[model samples]
Target: MAKELEGKVAVVTGAASGIGLASTGALLAAGARVVLVDRDDAALAAICSERGDAAIPLVIDLLDPKACATLAPRVLEMAGQIDILHANAGSYVGGDLVDADTAAIDRMLNLNVNVVMKNVHDVLPHMIGRQTGDIIVTSSLAAHFPTPWEPVYASSKWAINCFVQTVRRQVFKHGIRVGSVSPGPVISALLADWPEEKLREAKESGSLIEASEVAEVMMFMLTRQRGMTIRDVVMMPTNFDL
Candidate 1:
């Protein structure tokens, strides 16, 4: 039998690593052609070389306003149309608010929150015209709780949670499904800056989930029946407490 996503085209931002990379693999396995967007040209080239034509790499610095604004158009130029958008590009900022660099905080918020909104905004017109699409943002469990250690990071996710829900309501009539997958402490580079002790503790406690597991949830969301929308999937390792 043909796969559920056969003939679909998906665009995944931050596709060089972590959840984005894993999601690209899942999309390809489901028979969709995926466009891998990332700032790391070498990584994108390496992935594209292995994946062949099924994985198209678009080197993009999403921090550039011009680049973000023209993202949808660029994808359409490359793939002809977009059936799915995994707006998964982001950065992490942790530690107490006062201890964070002013510039670092700005960059984190821009990537985690602003860029997500712009990508969705840029793609909405096409999806609206087609009246069908799946847009999933990679959110965090931090959004749902006020984690004291990462105030800045958590705040960005909280903003995303609101954006996803509000946009879903507005676009459901147009047959566009907007949702977020909020996972807790996935094993990815986002945790690179975590205090060594905290990271070690979480690992020992089995509180860290693999990126592929989150991708599985994303696949489930994309494959759901048209009439239904898996609005928000909050997944965490069983041992994860918050």
Candidate 2:
């Protein structure tokens, strides 16, 4: 395998499991040293034990401004120079906007949107100073169209689309690629609480996608060439029949 990403440092938010874990493992396999950040320290430790020193587990409350501020410098401390950032941290609030509690909406916006925006703000200067970086965000299929059941999630993804695209235009000359990957519903630990039996039925009847598929697409988008500066890649399973 080509160590194209060797000697590079990657900071992946929400790296405990799901698509984040898959992406982390893929980057490691491709030879990049990784730092895993998540709220679940126990799980992150288990993952590090499995992957060893190639991975660093950082369990901090990302919602805290001080904590988030400390992230870039910590990443730099660990790897000297940062090359890739996967802004894949997000949460789901599956309720219609009208009746959804105000606090819940705020939580959704804070975790899914505000935190990511701040992560970009905190870490981007390092990339700009170095004159290189790849910023990858995990948005949802809800961004392109709409999902009535998850209005807040859809809104957050739309925000990400705007944020990343605007940054892409602003820093194109610096060679900083800002992009987002939108995936349809997938069977992930993130959705582990959902009725599996129901999901299986939906799968058989066509309703969601696989997590691995989404991760593969993310890797492709992150590693694309100069002429291939794709701003958005939307992937939905043929199973979206539901």
Candidate 3:
């Protein structure tokens, strides 16, 4: 309810739905001028309608490093400074290590790990110059648990978990707080869009974590004191076995 981000600028990927949409709402409510990015053009437009003029729409695949590089300055041109970046866009490919197709493996790795790192590397210089910003990477609980069947997706999450930890320590001196959220799953159009096989795999694993719950936690993390940041927060349903 506190407008901690008043007059600030925040960029969020995966903004069309799921945790990204929910978090976008929270950031807007907190009075942050938000830039919403997602590959889905129609959906992005729809989401922007909900946030109205305060939200800028970016329709680009985050997996493209070239696009990621252009994002910071374009965003700065709008709001003049960047205060928050929630890298929530990602994909899931289900398969065993030996059985996974090389193409699918590459897709998962590229989008999950490489795209995220590209965004961080590209936007960081500006954030560092400003000497104050927050970066939130969306990871998953599978990063910490046994999810051998989803080798590439799980591996990417684990890599991000490690990435956030190290970056938090390295960037604190620059007044940039880097952290990650590990969520179990979120029932969004994402599930409906997934390949039937992959959806079946994910649903068998567990129900999706609600978008609002994840959004609230992300908002809470970003609202901490100027010099403080939460390193990690993992979310799951109460009855989730893990």
Best by TM-score: 1
Off by over 4 Å in 3: 189-207
Superior by TM-score: candidate 1 or candidate 3? 1
Instruction: Look at candidate 3 and tell me the lDDT of residue 132.
Output: 85
Question: Candidate order by TM-score, highest to lowest?
Answer: 1, 2, 3
Off by over 4 Å in 1: none
lDDT per residue (tens digit) for residues 1-242 in model 1: 14789999999999999999999999999999999999999999999999989999999999999877878998999999999999999999999888999999999999998999999999999999999999999999998999889999999999999999999999999999999999999999999989999999999999999999999999999999998999999999989965
Instruction: List model 2 lDDT by residue over 1-242, tens digit each.
Output: 47767788888999997888988988898788999999898999999999978899888778887888788888888778778899888777665568768897788799888899898888888888988888899988888887776777789888888888898898778888888888888767656534557667766876777767777887787678765787888888776733
Question: How much lDDT does candidate 1 score?
Answer: 0.94
Each prediction's TM-score against the native? 0.98, 0.92, 0.90
Clashes of each: 0, 0, 1
Instruction: lDDT winner between 2 and 3, please give it.
Output: 3
Query: Which candidate order results from sorting by lDDT in descending order?
Result: 1, 3, 2
Worst 10 residues of 2 by lDDT: 189-198
Name the candidate, 1 or 2, with the larger lDDT value. Answer: 1
Two-way TM-score contest, 2 vs 3, winner = 2
Quote the positional error of residue 97 for candidate 2 in Å: 3.1
lDDT of each: 0.94, 0.82, 0.83
List the candidate 2 regions with Cα displacement exceeding 4 Å: 192-201
